[model samples]
Target: MSAYVVVELTVKNAVAKDLYSAAAGPIIREFGGEFIAGGAWSALAGVQGHPQGAIIRFPNRDSALGWYNSAAYQATLANRDARMTCSFRLIGN
Candidate 1:
């Protein structure tokens, strides 16, 4: 089965968040995740008022979890935490 990581983010500091985004891409790719979409979006139906949403698809749940838990990704994620308000979910399919 495949998996997807869905993230809702509100960036507090764009300049700092960009650093996380750039460094995080390679880590995601290493774990077989592909970027689906990311950036500002209008809340049309669910979860109103948030301006940012991101989705990434992975080969499977294990890969998704591995990526998130890996040392390299964890390091990058710290920057994200500092620069943004966000919620994340990993969905299995």
Candidate 2:
């Protein structure tokens, strides 16, 4: 099965968000993940949710979990303190 990590977040600090994305992107790709969407736009319906959202695809559940547990991603987490609040979901298909 293929797995995806979906993230919805609100940015509190632009600098910190940028720093986090910069540091985290490489780690995500290192785990053979691809960003499906990472941007802002009108919701057009229902609850708007967060201003920022992203989806990343991985080969399987293990790859998704591996990226989440990786040392590189853990180091990059320092930039997120109060910078943004996020909710993540792991989906399989």
Candidate 3:
């Protein structure tokens, strides 16, 4: 089964998020994460949802979790915190 990182963000600093996303992309890719969806939203229809979001799919839950917990990503987290408030989850089915 595939796993996904569902990210819900409220951006206060668009510039920072943009930079962070660009930097984070390669790291995510290294862990086999592919960006499937991103951007502002009209609604959140599921449980534990938010208005602005993105989804990155990985081959499995472990891959997704590894990417999320990796040191490279941790180093980049400050930029995300500077730009937005986010709620995230790793989900699989």
Give candidate 2 regions above 4 Å deviation. 41-45
Model 3 clashing-pair count: 0
lDDT of 1 by residue, 1-93 (tens): 989999888999999888888899999999999999988887667756557989999999999999999999888766889999898899996
What would you estimate as the lDDT of candidate 3? 0.88
TM per candidate: 0.89, 0.85, 0.89
- After superposition on all CA atoms, what RMSD does each candidate show versus the true structure? 1.5, 1.7, 2.0
Where is model 1 more than 4 Å wrong at Cα? none
Model 2, 22-85: lDDT tens digits are: 8788898999899988887468889977888899999998998999999888776667656798
Looking at model 1, report the run of 10 residues with the lowest lDDT sum: 42-51
Task: Using TM-score as the measure, name the better of candidate 1 and candidate 2.
Answer: 1
Query: Residue 77 of candidate 2: its Cα lDDT?
Result: 68
Clashing pairs in 2: none
